[model samples]
Target: MSVDRVRTAAAARGLEIEIRESPRASSLEEAAALRGITPADIVKTLVVKGRGDQYLFALIPGDRSISWPKLRALLGVNRLRLPEPELALEATGYERGTITPLGSTRDWPVYADERMTGRRVSMGAGAHGWTLFVDADALIASYDATVADISDPIETIR
Candidate 1:
């Protein structure tokens, strides 16, 4: 259902996207290897619960981690924590490894790490062994995401 929803949405936008299948990747590093792309090109969709049970999505480069301070500052909240896998699945209609910003059950606020702009990115496709590739900017536009520096300091590829 989730993959179908994403396919439908992208098709509606006239996006000719490619879906790749690979071994199950339990982490960003593993996904990167399967996709033959650097970790930076892998977009990690994180489900975060902010103040007052507010759920939000943060897209970060696989090579980097989320900067809690920066995220909190941007959100104007004192704290944030990851929702449990069950809660995330319930909210997004997809499990942890299959979660994608596309076709979420709720149109939560989306924040894409600034570093992902203008690049090609890979994200989950609502199922294990499936991935969706698209222009980072286009994905952000589709999600109506706000671009910001929500990444922790980490080594970057030049």
Candidate 2:
């Protein structure tokens, strides 16, 4: 049902999206391998808990980590934490391995890092082994996501 909803939404917007199935990717490196794309192209979705137990989703580049202080400032909250896997699944209708910003049970306020602009990115598809690819700009526009600098610099190993 979640997958179908996402497909329907994409179709309504005339987005030519591709859903690919593969062995479950537990990390960005594995996801990149499964999708045949570089790590930079995979968009990682994180469920964060803000003040008053409110939850929001942040879409960030696979190669980066969320800057909690920056995100908290943007959200106007003092602190934030990653939700437990069970809570995350309950809120998004997707397990830890399959949470995407699209088609969540709630219309979550989405925050995308500035690095995602003008790129082709891949995200989870409501199930393990399935992934959805779309234009980063289109995704933000369709979801009414706010663009911000929410990532901490990650050094790449040579």
Predicted structure with the largest lDDT when compared to the true one: 1
Write one digit per residue (lDDT tens) for candidate 1, span 1-158. 66888788687766667777767767768878888888899888999987675799999988889998999999888889998899898878889977886778887899999999988889888887689998998888877889999998575669
What's the TM-score of each model vs. the native?
0.88, 0.89
Among residues 3 or more apart in sequence or in different chains, the pairs in candidate 1 whose N, CA or C atoms overlap within 3 Å are none
List, residue by residue over 1-158, the lDDT tens digit for candidate 2.
66787787688766767887767657778769877889889888999887665888999898898999999899888889998898898878888867887778877789999999999998878877688999999988887899999998787679
Give all candidates' CA lDDT scores.
0.85, 0.84
In model 2, state the lDDT of residue 83: 88
Clashing pairs in 2: none
Q: Distance from true position, residue 23, model 1, in Å?
A: 1.5
